[model samples]
Target: MTVTELLDRAHALGSDPRNTNFAGGNASAKGVERDPVTGGDVELMWVKGSGGDLGTLTAEGLAVLRLDRLRAMADTYPGVEREDEMVAAFDFCLHGKGGAAPSIDTAMHGLVDAVHVDHLHPDSGIAIATAQDGPELTARIFGDRVLWVSWRRPGFQLGLDIAALKEANPQAIGCVLGGHGITAWGETSQECQANSLEIIRTAARYIEEHGRPEPFGPVIHEPLDEVARRERAAALFPLVRGLCSTDVRQVGHYTDSPEVLDFLSRAEHPRLAALGTSCPDHFLRTKVAPLVVDLPPEASLEEVTERLRVLHAAYREEYAAYYARHAVESSPAMRGADPAIVLVPGVGMFSFGKDKQTARVAGEFYVNAINVMRGAEAVSVYAPIPESEKFRIEYWELEEAKLRRLPRPKPLAGRVALVTGGGSGIGAATARRLAAEGACVVVADRDLGSAEKVAAELGARAHRPSDVAVAAAVDVTSEEQVVAAVRQAVLAFGGLDLVVNNAGLSLSRALLETTVDDWNLQHDVMARGSFLVSREAARVLLAQDLGGDIVYISSKNAVFAGPNNVAYGAAKADQAHQVRLLAAELGAHGIRVNGVNPDGVVRGSGIFASGWGANRAAVYGVEEEKLGEFYAQRTLLKREVLPEHIAAAVFALTGGDLSLTTGLHIPVDAGVAAAFLR
Candidate 1:
């Protein structure tokens, strides 16, 4: 088969989430190439490179190596202890692209005689592959269809083992790597793909017939409303993350879907999950097992927090003991990382990572592992790769290299910010700026699509490896939605540190022409909305017991009145007053509340984008396009107040230099005397 066709088949195999996750699994195809110097046909093998996702595999992501060279290197390869030498050998034998690093398993792929080879960590296959009785059980089911390779730390030794196994049984279709995954091969790409799927599907069907009976998994508890669920998630995630962080800052991601809640509901969840990962590959991302926290249904938030600390301490103690038992006197002490997964009995599970994306990936793999464990236990006893094997994999130098490659985090790392009306204007600009500074941001807006778009944009630019941008549809005026937004921020990024109350609506009609609806709408969003959001946000900040900043996007209309703008101006005036009162009350909790009053920000703002500028310009008998210039020329500094300018002022108020400043207004208007703070 052609190289393009093999990649297409590889992408097809990875498309199934059940087969492999993002940036996981590898594949290869064998083809002949013309030697540049000799102009003679030479055998070569193309394998997926490091960091390449099989779901989106391309020719560029494949590393082509001379088949004869690879086999020759393997024949005289150094032992597993010499990982550096092994890597150098692979690098020196590149026949295709020279820059990309091939998968560490390329040696094994080279040893196999098949023209097309694929490796995957499919959950079903892993369920059997990682079982203690996996070899015996696999032989019983697949019989001679597949061979079972015992668990060994993935490296040159494992490759040698594969080569030995193939040499012994050249007719074997494929082999299940004990406590790891599976390999399938054929003379054609289609044959390889079909063989892999057949193995996975057969294993799944066997589990159905012989595995554990139904109803063993937990049941979904009575459903909680969106707001209630988010509230609890917000309050508990921070405590869990704090405990998992071990003096370092860690971002957390939580999941409480009905399926997950049901899984946690099982009485034997802790023991069942503690059996270890469904496959050895998951150990790198999820660690060995989850840290289970017991929370009775009647426990209060304070009680839960205290219980989590105690349980987390116990987990750490156990991990230390485990490491001590495994280490040799000559080996450097392996630093123990926090348990990647946290199980809250009667609640759900939480996952921790340096950033949100890593946390999510950990959570996803943990969930899959749980499912596999349940299925395996039903048919037979669930047994994972031995602790000795897992310890070796966890401390492997090659696995640790992935973490070392990550870029250093930027400033503001571990902080969480919520930006209201973040879909556009100063709010969106502020969200992007905060994300760039290494803060995880929650983009909350009245429009869900807009918020999601902004979140997607910002997430793409995150400076921290695990930092994330999340979106929430929220109406600041609605108490339920406002509280939920605060909870969303907390649940997404551990806790809230910065809140920007920037959502507003304007009524530009004269008093004689204004209706009650115009007056109430303006006040509901600008005055009442800011009040609700600030109150809820302050509640979360206080619960976290961490100092935080709340900045309101008040208007210059609050200080300087404009004709036919009674509703908007009066509401903004009331908002500015509320900020002072909030500061007075929240200051004792180390929460700073301030306001930014921006004047004549006619361009790149949501207020004007929604037709407000056209209406205001018509009232002044000027073209809408010229209003920005008009406002700029009218200012003392003769400069337009851009959204970014307002964003900078908001940043200043929340930053360290303004640590002692509160109960104040910072104007973004360019030297407008009337708009200046009193």
Candidate 2:
């Protein structure tokens, strides 16, 4: 297959949760390339790069290696494995346009004598692969179609062993790597993929026949139960969240997928859940073992808190002991193991990370690992790589290097934010700024498409693109919608840390000319909308017991009213008043309420897009072309206020500088003396 076609198939395999999780596996294809130096057809292998996901694999993501050079490098490592030296040699074998770090399994792929090779951690297949009697079972299940290789650390030695097995059993289509995963190969990509899928299905059927006593179906639940679960989440989430916090500021995420539910609901859950990962690659995300926090459904809030405290203390001690055991052999002394997966007896799994998407990635892999182990326990036993081997994988310098490649966490890395009217104007700019600083933002607007576009743009640039931003359709005036939006944000990102209330409308008419509709829309969106958003956001922040920021986008007209803009000015005045009252009310809880009063932001703003500036220009007896210059000349700074300027001011208030200040309005209009703080 062409490289593009191979990537497409690889993505199809990796994206399926049943097949692989958290970029756990890689694939490669052998192709002939014309050597630029000698017009000769030289054999090259293109393997998946180290840090890129198969789900988003591109041609550029594949690391190209000259097959012969890689094998020659392998020949030099004849005895005790030096992982570091071996990796350097692999890097040295890069052929053409091949600087990307090849997958750690590249040598094995190059050694396989097939045009196409695929390695996967399919849950069903791994369940059997990690079983204690995996070798015997392999003979019984595939009956010599596959060879069985005993547990070996992945490095130069493992590559050599795999090649030896292939040489001895030339007719075998694939091999089951005991205590690790599955490797399949064929002359074509389709044949290799089909071989892997058939093995996975056959193993799954075998597991079902031998392991489970009863057939399993999806867990049934009523609509009200889900509502109750969310309610419980609001009330008790903080207790567990507090236990998981590495410090006072960082927040963690909770995952409650159907797969998690199934695994946590198993009969021997506590024993099975505490076991190690299905393979070493999984340890990168889930740690060696999970931390179990058994919160019974009937437990009271006080009981829940006490149980979590006790469990957290014990989990920490166990992690310390595990590290101590391995630290002596680890080249660099190991760091303390932080809990990755937390299992709640009655609830589903909750995975912790520095941010939301990191947590999601860890959670997905852990859930898959749990399913695989359960399948193995049913038939025989889930005997994954032993503790010593798992330690090597966890502390390996080459593997740890990947974590260092990520940018340092921003101040708002673990925080969640909500931006009303975020599809356009200052709201959109503010959402982007917050997302850039590492906050998971919700872009909420009446325009779903615009909101989605804004969210998509932010997500595309984020480190964890999938979880950085989400779009929500909200009419801020409706109490139900406002409350629902807050709940959704909490459910999606675990909790709320900041809220920007920016949705508003304008009515360019005097009180006498204004209809009730005009007055109501302006007041409802500006005055009432800000109130609703602030109230709901406060509710979540208070429940979280974490200090947060609530900012309102008001108008300078509140202090300096325009001749025809009565409704808008009066409503903004009321909105500013709401900020003060909210600040006074929520200050004790450390929830800061503030406002940014901006005027004449004509560029890239909804107010200008909707022609509000043209109407105002007519009243001022100036052309629309001169309106920007007029506002610029009017400000003491002699510069027109841009949406980004307003957005920067909003971020300033939410940031550390004004952490002690609240209930104040900062103007963004070129100094309007009349609108200045008295």
Candidate 2 stretches with Cα past 4 Å from truth are 38-41, 214-224, 247-254, 329-337, 447-449, 460-466, 508-524, 558-567, 574-593, 607-615, 623-629, 654-664
Residues 468-491, model 1: lDDT tens digits: 788999998799999778777777
Error of 1 at 488 (Å): 4.2
Per-residue lDDT, model 2, residue 462, is 54
TM-scores, one per candidate: 0.86, 0.88
Per-residue accuracy of model 2 over 1-678 as CA lDDT, tens digit each: 568768977988887867777667888888888999999988888889887777778888899988889878755775755655777777777887635687678878988778888888888878888888899888888887888888877776777777888778888888888888888888888898888787778888888777755222233322124556566665555555545664434455666666666665555666666777858767777888887766555567678667877887898888878777876654555555457777765566667677876778788778778777777777787778878778777887877776677777786778889999999988899999898877889999988899999999998855565589988889999989988888778667777889999988786876699999989998999899998898888777876677889999998987896799888899999998998999999999989999999998888788777878888888888998788888888888899898898889888998677889999999999888878877
Error of 2 at 546 (Å): 4.6
**Total residue pair clashes for candidate 2:** 0
Least well predicted 10-residue stretch by lDDT in candidate 1? 215-224
Clashing pairs in 1: 211-378, 211-379, 212-378, 212-379, 355-466, 356-466
